[model samples]
Target: MKNSKGGIYKRFVKRPMDFILSLIAIIVLSPIFLIVALLVRTKLGSPVLFKQKRPGLNEEIFMMYKFRTMTDERDENGNLLPDSVRLTRFGKLLRSTSLDELPELLNIIKGDMSIVGPRPQLVRDMVFMNQKQRERHTVLPGLTGWAQVNGRNCVTWEEKLSYDIKYLSNITFLEDWKIIFMTVAKVFKRDGISTEGMDTAEDFGDYLLRIGQIDNRTYIKGLEKSKKIAN
Candidate 1:
């Protein structure tokens, strides 16, 4: 296990530190947690927590947790509605305030996440990543990261990948603290939470193609074939 320093901190020291800090954080933040839980239950109705599978260290899939910030509204045919419609004003508030991300601190306690590192992406979305980009998984995913504090959803996927690579190469105590401080400021300013008009970040396929992970012609052909099969 790599520490904030290039050399690993003694497990005796690091694990205990993680435990103490996580315990204190949970205790100090419990009130806020309760309030968020109540608000999610009252406003979103059911499922006060949102859980999804995310790649952790070494690309291992783990169930990541978050506070529920969207409704489970479905159409008549039982298909889910679009994000924009299912995402309510309260949900938007949770996102803008980043209250929805609070539950991930529990993941840090569980040893599935770090306090600072590259943010995890879904396994489904990993299709766009080539073998090289897969190096981000060498370290544990984080609650907030360098790329996130930099430009987040406002930046293209390639740009985010470059930041993630740079972070991996330059992991240090100072860098971690720098990212943490920047994250606080970014959250306060509510910067780069989402793309300009999209409910979430835009699809990463184009960025992948631009980086030569996939050729446009091949990408188009593959999509066309898939659509033909579906039809």
Candidate 2:
């Protein structure tokens, strides 16, 4: 299982630790969860929890949950409006505070994620990654990761993937706790919540296109692959 790369801690202890910690977190955070759920439902209309398919350990797909932060407002053509139009002030508050991520504790308990690892990304994002870059999938995805604490939505796609690789190269108990501590600090500082002046974080494919790293043909292919995987 390549888990030996992380030594005994990653091989034998990580999952159990994730389970225990997540369960405790869920219990302790239950009231906050309920409050957030009610707020999201009342403010966002319905589906208080946002669910999306994300690539996890070994490139496996799983449904990651978060509090809904955008309205489903669409244009006259029935197309969804741009994120800038749908993201409300309340939504931004949820994101900035990281309350939107509270639901992911359930994912950690469910074994689809861990407390610290590479962040799970969109299927469209994974389609753009090469095999070596995708090696981040050798370990489970996390609610908060090395890349997130470093620059999060502020960093370029290439830099984010590099951070993920750097993290997986050495997975230890101390490293995980360090990430957790850094994450707490980052959250309080409200750093890197979104790309400056952007309503939402750019997707990997969109970032590549903006930088001219992939042509229209390759972009279209990736979009198709992402759709296929989602289906």
Instruction: Assess every candidate by TM-score.
Output: 0.85, 0.97
Off by over 4 Å in 1: 1-5, 9-17, 206-231
Give the Cα error of residue 103 in candidate 2, in Å: 0.5
Model 2, residue 66: distance off in Å is 0.6
Root-mean-square deviation of each candidate, in angstroms? 4.8, 1.3
The Cα local distance difference test for each model comes to 0.78, 0.92
In every candidate, how many clashes are there? 0, 0
For model 1, how does the per-residue alpha-carbon lDDT over 90-191 read when each residue is reduced to its tens digit?
999899989999888888889888888788886645555667777888787888888998899999887888888788877666777788899999999999
The Cα error of candidate 1 at residue 42, in Å, is: 0.2
Candidate 2 lDDT over 48-136, as tens digits, reads 99999998887888999999999999989999999999999999999999999999999998999999999999999999998888888
On TM-score, the leading prediction is: 2
Q: How does candidate 2 fare on TM-score?
A: 0.97
Off by over 4 Å in 2: 1-4
- Report the Cα lDDT for candidate 2: 0.92
